[model samples]
Target: MMRSNAAILVCVLAGSFVMAQEPDTKTLFKEFGRSVKSDDITLSFVLLNNRTVDVLFQAPGKYAVRARANQSTTFYVQGMPEKDMVVDTKFFVEQDGHTYEASSLNIKNFDGNTVTKGTRVDGMIQLGTKLDLTHPFTVRGSHGSVEFVLSPEALKLAEPAPAAAPPPE
Candidate 1:
């Protein structure tokens, strides 16, 4: 009876460990856009992870992506303001059987000076001459990469408004 009880206890503890080791698949949603003098577009989507991220793309420029993980820290440099850390900084989009890459660097100040060392890297790269967010794409950086799929719900978010009915007759 004693040996049987010990075996049962071991099995219970093992099961608990396994359950704790499983990764959590949390989802996050964000939508934002801005215009500086030209046409602007707003993008919204669901991320597969719980990390907070911002995706920005200028009409005639490149895309700037930032992400923060659980272990990120906010700190201030000697002469600079507080900043958050980011990890594994890179971005890539796969469309029409072609892959485009963007290089990322550590976040800097307006004068091109490094503020605080962060796990997240920030940089801009030319996205060619077209911008297509309809297709699925992935954003990768120091922390890691996440693939975003345009679900039916996301499609609705990207839809255009209906035309006016003949100027109300």
Candidate 2:
């Protein structure tokens, strides 16, 4: 009887494992990055921890971010309901017929634990936080956090300050 019970328990656990929902972190991150770079705009995302709001990015920059509890959406205008709290910023890139944007930060697994890439010369970067775009950086937030940024090249065009009106009207 004990043997049969053990077998049944093993089978149940195996079944659960097979049915479990596990996110593909690598693919998700890559996709996020690609999307950001493909579009020249800043986007926003909501961090979710334990099925509750963790943090909110006023505006997600231009890149991509994938964490355990985060999702993102992009919009072109305002007055629309906040879908996941999307915000547009002055950061983004356009290339190969697509636009890419910045993310608040990029976090990934490092040394068997999650680590933010602070600022790097040839790696990902955190979205909203400022950094040298030519250089690279990444940020990790509590629960789940990710934002996008614009490449320096794209930022120049994306951010078009109106010409000063001759000092005064």
Local distance difference test, each candidate: 0.35, 0.31
Per-candidate TM-scores read 0.34, 0.22
41: Cα error in model 1, Å? 26
Runs in model 2 lying further than 4 Å from the true structure: 1-4, 7-20, 35-89, 92-169
Residue-by-residue lDDT tens digits, candidate 2, 18-121: 54633244422332343221122222232122211111222242212223223332222111112222222233433334444544222322112222333111
Worst 10 residues of 2 by lDDT: 47-56
Best by TM-score: 1
Each candidate: RMSD to true structure?
Answer: 18.3, 21.1
Instruction: Give the alpha carbon lDDT tens digit for every residue of 1-169 in model 1.
Output: 9999999999899889865743232311332111111111111223211222322333332212322211221111111223432222234545567777643333333223433532222333233333355676554333334455556644554443244358444
Model 2 TM: 0.22
